[model samples]
Target: MQNAITELEELTLNGASRSFLKETAKWCKFLSIMGFIFTGLMLVGSFFIGALYENLPQTQAMPFNVGGMMTGFYLVCGLIYIFPIYYLYQFSVKMKKALISKDNDVLAKAFEMLKSHYKFIGVFTIIILSIYILAAVVGIIGLVASS
Candidate 1:
C-alpha cells in the first residue's frame, strides 16, 4: 500500500498524456455545456407540462393530477442531473487551466471534480437500479395478491 502510494506520488503526465488530457477536457466541456442546455430545456418544459396536459381531453378522465405529477417529476430529474454536469464543467475548466499553468493544486482539484462527477453518476445509477428492483418486487407481489 505504501509502495503504491509512493509510486502514485511520483506519477507524472508525459507529453502524449498531457495532449490527451487537453483533448479530453475540451470534449468534457462540450458535453457538459450540452447537458446544461438540455437540462435547462427540461426544467423549462416541466413548467409547461401541467398546462399542456390540462388541454388534453384524456387528462380530465384521470382521477389524479397526472400533469402536475409529471411536471414535478421532470423538475426533480433536471435538478438531479445538474450536479454531475456541474462537476464535469468544473473538471474541464480546472483541467485546462491546470495544464496551461502547470499548477499541481489546480490539477488535483480538477481530478477531484472528475471523481465527484463519476461518483455522483455511480450512486445515481445504483439508486435507480434499486428503485427498479423494488418496483419489480412490488409489481410481482401485487400480481400475486390479485390472483
Candidate 2:
C-alpha cells in the first residue's frame, strides 16, 4: 500500500483561469446576497401568513390549514436556501483571498466551498423532483378513485 501511494502535485492557475475565477467570485457574491434577501423575505412572510389566515374568514373553513402549511413551507424553503447561499458566499470570500494572495491552499478551499454549493443545489433539485413525481402519482390515483 505504501508503494502504491504517490506524491500530490500542486495546482497552478493560468492567467485566464485566474481572471475567470475572480469574475465567478463576483457573481457568486452577488447571487448569494440575492439568495439571502429572498430567504429573509420568505421567513418574514411565514410569520405574516398566520395573521393573514386569521383575518380572512374564507381560509378558516378550508379542509386543510393552509396558513400553517404555508408558513411551514416558507420556513423550510428559507432553511434549505441557507446552505447554498452560505457556501457561495464562503467561496466568493475565499476565492478573493486566494487570488489576491496567490495561495494554492486557499484556492483549494474556495473550490471546495464551490463544490458544496453545487452539491447542495443538486441534492435539493433531486428532492424536489422526487416530490413532484410523488405528487403526480397521487393526483392520478385520486382522479381514478373519484371516477
What stretches of model 2 exceed 4 Å from their correct place? 1-10
Give the per-residue lDDT of model 1 (tens digit) for 54-132: 6788823687888898899999999999999999999999999999999999999999999999999999999999999
Model 2, 1-147: lDDT tens digits are: 333334235347799999999999999999999999999998999979866865676833678877788788889888989999999999999999999999888988999999999999999999999999999999999999999
Candidate 1 TM-score over all chains jointly:
0.93
The top-ranked prediction according to lDDT is 1
User: What stretches of model 1 exceed 4 Å from their correct place?
Assistant: 1-7
Clashes of each: 0, 0
- What C-alpha lDDT, on a 0 to 100 scale, does residue 104 get in candidate 1? 93
Give per-residue lDDT, candidate 1, residue 123.
99
What are the lDDT figures for the candidates, one per model?
0.96, 0.89
Model 1 weakest 10-residue run by lDDT: 53-62
Pairs in steric clash, model 2: none
